[model samples]
Target chain A: MKVLPYFVILPLAGSFLVIFIDSVLKDRKVRDTVADILANVIMLTLFILTLTLFGQSCSYFVGGWRPPFGINFLLDGLSHLMLVAVNLIALLSGIFSINYMSQYTARRHYWALFLLMLTGMNGVLLSGDFFNLFVFLEIASVASYALVGFGTEAEELEASFKYMVMGAVASSLVLMAVAVLYSRFGILNMSYISAAMPGESFDWLLKFSLFLFITAFSIKGALVPFHAWLPDAHPSAPAPVSAMLSGVLIETIGIYALTRVIFNVFSYKSILLANLGVISMMVGVLLALGQTDIKRLLAYSSISQVGYIVLGLGLGTPLGIFGALFHLINHSIFKSLLFLNSGSVFYRLKTRDLNSMGGLNKVMPVTGATSLVASLSISGLPPFNGFFSKLIIIIACVQSGHPVLAVWAVIGSVLTLAYFMKVQKLAFFGKLKEINKEIKESPFFMSASVIILAALCLATSFILLPGVRNKILTPAVNAVLNPTNYRMMVYIK
Target chain B: MKREEKNRAPTTELNGMSEIVKTVCNWIAGFIFLFGCYITAYGHLTPGGGFAGGVILAASFILIVLSFGKDKISPLLPRKRAEMIEAAGGLIFIFTVWTAIYAGASFCGNFIFKKWSCANFKLLSAGFIPLLNIAIALKVMAGLFLVFFVLSITRVILEGEKLKMVKEE
Candidate 1:
């Protein structure tokens, strides 16, 4: 249905509408109400469409032309899953931002940029062509660069500049790869490339392109070595923006593209994928342990959590794929919740320095409690979503006969717990400082977003139940496990 | 400060030959600017694309500013307006893609309003590819121009203010 594209279109439209309304409308109340209602409505519509599209395979041929030639928008289980996660987080962030962004100048521009970011994420999820995906990725990246520099402080500018340079490099690499693919395959559509890849062996050009793609995607995903920009950039952005960056942007665009390239384009090789996975997992956690800034710590942790997803996907087993997808969803929820909690802390206390914050729990119950839940969830405590996903991944590693990898996974989890526990002790549990004595709870909208996300953090663990798991995770895993099916389904011209 | 001003007199006279070199560099820069425009216009059919073409044009404009000064560039295209034009160019690119969808094609799918299958002899018959190149050229030129212009102005303003302070002291 046309509704498929509207998932991206509506937010983009909302972005412009917010700008228009804010400029024309004089009253702050009217502007706020309009922006709030519009963003919520747009995200709700996307969430509904994602649900409606679930369990069904749909393709939108741009200009009604058939595939292998025309650009196509394919919605299978994987895209559907990512769509739900991205929009849900965007909705929560919009709710959080309603009050939070008021403290900043140019609230309208903030909303505009936020919606554009959502548009970019959704576009990346739904795109079926490489070039289209790159364009949308740039859209999201450029918007994020500006958002990261939104504060206009010296550190923020420095972070933004560094991020822009790295991100631009990544984008250029992706573009070059796409160019090579186009010249080699004589086609730009992914399905076309996948279909054409099997019978023929690619020369060094193709291999070099693959190397570039992997390097670029890994940089975007913030795997350990290429991760310098992340610590600075994530913490430098405004909190809601930080939440979105850490939550879904890396997963959907970076890991998702890498997975698509590995599984569909190049053919999955278990050993290579697994090696990358284990290295990223260990290295990410090791780096994360040294960070003291709250957001920077979470940023490192985001890289490590992404490693878990990759480790699962690289296992190339049904259970592994299921675990990876489940963990992907769970991470989006809790990580965003954690960042939102941090946003709240920044809101009331006016600083992100963890050393400056102490005993905030008594004063800001919603933030403290929600962040506690998020901390436990991220550390893989039981009954929360993270525990089940991590368990599935570790079990998958063991079942796949990589017990050593499983051990490493366990070590990573322990490190995760230790660091987050350190965060809890330092930021939320110590003696209340006189400087923070006057700290109050965040605004109502902000608290509401956190509470909703906290509930999701607990409730999503039930997605591991058999019925729900089969309905959601099975189709997605099937999409990856059977890339041939994807080709057959779309190339029906 | 007075001593530095006095020191400047001999240096300015001693560097008169360098100023002549700078003037020659400026004219060469202007010629390079025209060359870049030619490359951008023909990018779709050749090796260069909007991005490369835009950067080249911006570089040429920037060389002129470097050799001369911002005051000369400002009157031709005010810095603020150039920034606005960059944003507008980006918008135009997005709008063009969306317009294709509105016109019954997918986003960025080029729809020929009228198609003429010409014998392969005419460059004028290149269809929508030429238009796409032009749109990209405009966007890239504006974007790079704004970025360079902003950087140059900021340097001039900040350094000029510092020099003024030194003089006052």
Candidate 2:
């Protein structure tokens, strides 16, 4: 508990430390190495620390002030699960960046911004109040905006601007909703808000604020109509950044934050949310089918997968929530792997267009294999983790007498497979491009990151086991199922 | 009278101001910088805190750059040194938090001299707020100046090239 906030503090320190070391050191090699080591160490440390918080539920108040008076760091099953996914992806991306980012200038600033983004994600997960959530969300959003334009090319700038505009609008909506909630209840802590929200007067003001939340969070999550920025923004960023953005960043601020609010804070699942989820799922996959850029395809697929989670959550059943939570972790794993695979291809070939490349497996065995694994996992092939979660969601749908949703979900899954197979065939398995004769396998670090993720793609199936499920996924399911338990021990005056 | 006229001659550039504005700017820049420091250092006891003071200090530098042109005054506060200052400020803040934790308090906990020593509301009364304020001030001051400096440099290069092209033609 004493070390809880360091999940946020360490990354903040690491970012500054990277910049400081760069300024002090004259040798570029030494600076890069030190920055790489520091970034990996920070992520690794946070990973271990977050794991230590597993199986325990506690809150740490900043400055030792009790909740309702001062800011508190809340750790429960849901945040703990998110912490694991965020830190794990960050660590892998940090390693992958070691070799990949060497091609870019001002590696120091890149590392600094990366660390700041991690700090923001961790802070978002841990903070127990609404205002802090907005602040951390801004931190993460600002860093991502800079990162998407890290290349500083014309298209990159355009994409970043689009992302930033949408992000700012969403943030303002969130702030207004927070203000409304505060005006209604005179409180900012989520637990207190949840405790007080149950009065019979779930009135127009409250409903309006909840509607604002749905709009704000849906925009952040990139649900259907709100998702235009994602395809452009995710593809424009550098590869590791693409991996983080497509993999964990959207899920953290978008899916995770949205669900946490609707599930716990609002403690009510609207039918509208469910319909939006179905639309996102169908629209995202269909739009993804026409994409040639591997990263953009993966980005669209992220929206589709997120739709599954939201759809499951919107069902408002134990099995639906379970499936949603399970799919969240599985999606983080495979989608990041897929993005990293795309990054590797981009790194070696210097292009993201799938049509321009062919037969990469002849030169890049590890990338080819890992991406194949990712492709399989995401397509809901048997034995990979995606299958189990998708199966559970389908089961939940059928059990809840929503076979139509289950049918659309099956259609979405089939579309997912078709697009990924298209990606694999076009980019990896056909005749080697005559101009791409010199393409080489990615370095050890990049390969290692993907291989580990791909391995976990198959390995995470253990989560559905009774014992493992009870320890990790079940607690989170319970946390989401019971919003009233959020007030645990933090006596609300 | 001839020597006085020479001393009062206007600057060379079309956009630059006359000598009086430049001289007044140079004179007030130091006061602005000092006043910024005064506010940041006593931020614990006063209303004007680190963020406000830092912006003021950065504005003083921006004023000098604007009046004298970036080429003349940037040597005193170059982008390199500004980035260094920004990083150092961040380091100071996180280190302070780390020390608080190392002393068996929580992160951001105030472990330094907790109780006020006297009845007087001295500048050093707070345990960590002043220190944190100074660090934030340094970061904000350097960071804002860097942003101004970089944007100005880009504009200079673009416009300077056009000027060179006109000269060549």
Candidate 3:
């Protein structure tokens, strides 16, 4: 409970501290090395901090102010899980970027912004008040917008601009929804809001706010109908930025925020979630099918995979919640691995266009092997973590009397394989192109980052073991399945 | 008529506005900046907080840049110094919150002194809100100035240099 504020404080402090070091230390070598070490250590510490919070649910009020009157921080089962996933991936990406970002200038700014985004994610996850959540959400989103265009190319600039505009509009709508809720209930605390909010007494204004939240958060999340900005923004960023964006950013800022609000606050949006999930599942896969750019394909696949999590959660059963949370973990791991792999390939070949290369397996064997691990994991093959989560979601669907939704999900999974197979064949296999003969593997850190994630792809399957599931995944599922537990803990005063 | 029109074409005392605008700006900007500090210092007890006071402080710098060109204004505080100051502000703000937790309070919990009645309508009484406001004001002043300077100076270099070239041509 006491350590909750460090989640935001450390990252915010680290960002400006790096700036101070960079400006003070004239030597470029020393500056970069110090900043790199500083960032990685901070992220690793944050990851460890999240791990400690498991099964030890807690709440903290800022400035010693009590809830409903002062901003509060709540760490329950769901947040702890997401906190670990986000920080773990953030550390991996930070390590990957040490080498990957050297190609670009303003390396100081990049590291600073990366930590700022990390701070935003951590704060968004930790905050129990809606107002503070929105503020942290903006911190993460704004940092990402700047990072997306860090390369400063015309396309990168344009994509970041597009992301910024739509993001601002979405933020406005979310704020408006928050305002309506606050006006209705006279408070913005999640526990207080849930306590006061119920279908029996809720008026049309509440319903309108719910729609505003769902639609706005969907746009933020890049769901099918509101996903136009992602394909451009994700692929346009530098590789590790792309990895962070697709791997954790979308989930934390978009999916996690939306689900938490819908499940805990609104308490009955399952039908809306179910329909949106099916549509995104279908649309994302279809759109991903024709993408030739490696990162763009991965970006679209992120949308499709998110659909699966949403579908599971929308089932509103304990098993379904478990499936959703499990899939969320699997996606963050494997998707990050795939994106970092793409970044490594881009680092060597300086391109994301799939058709420009061939038979990279003969030369860059590490990239080949690791990407294979990631691809199979994402495709839901056996022994990998993704397979079990996909299986659980499908089983949950069938058990919940949603046979048709199960079929659609299975179809989506099959489509996932088809597109990934296309990617592997075109980008990593086939005849070796003359232009790519001298291609080499990535720097040491880049290789290590992907290897770590690929290993995690296999490692996360252990969470399925009966004992381990009870320890990790079960509590997260329980937090969402029963909001009353959260209310009692947060408002126990 | 042509000579009278030429006299009002907005050319300056060399590179900036007329001497009157520059002189008036020099006096009033200091007052505005001081008032901004006043707001930030008393933010906990007053209506104006960090954000409002920050904009006001930034406006003073913007005013200086507007009347006097880049040359006259930036020499007082270089761009790099401005950035370092901004970074320092951020660090100070974090430092306050970090210390609060170490003082046996939660994160961002005010634990400096007299935690109970510290904020009881006193200027220096509020544990850290006033200091946080000052930090924010510093960052905003530097950042807002940096943005104005960069944009305005870029125009000067791009257009002024081009215009000089045109005159030579």
Q: Arrange candidates by lDDT, descending.
A: 2, 3, 1
Give the better candidate number (1 or 2) by lDDT: 2
Chain A TM-score compared with the true chain A, each model in order:
0.97, 0.98, 0.98
lDDT of 2 by residue, A156-223 (tens): 87899999999999999999999999999998998888888864458988998988888888888899
The 10 consecutive residues of candidate 2 chain A with the worst lDDT sum are: A484-493
Candidate 2 lDDT at B58 equals 96
Chain A, candidate 3, TM-score of 0.98
Q: Each prediction's DockQ?
A: 0.11, 0.29, 0.30
All candidates' chain B TM-scores are: 0.69, 0.79, 0.78
Between prediction 1 and prediction 3, which has the larger TM-score? Answer: 3
Question: Ten consecutive residues with minimal summed lDDT in candidate 3 chain A?
Answer: A484-493
Docking class of 2: acceptable
lDDT of 1 by residue, A138-205 (tens): 98888998899887656787899999999999999999999998988888888778877854466888
Cα lDDT of model 3 by residue, A279-372, tens digit: 9988999999999989999999988998998888888888888898999999999998999999888888988899996799988999999999
Quick one: best DockQ, which candidate?
3
* Alpha-carbon TM-score of each model against the true structure: 0.80, 0.94, 0.93
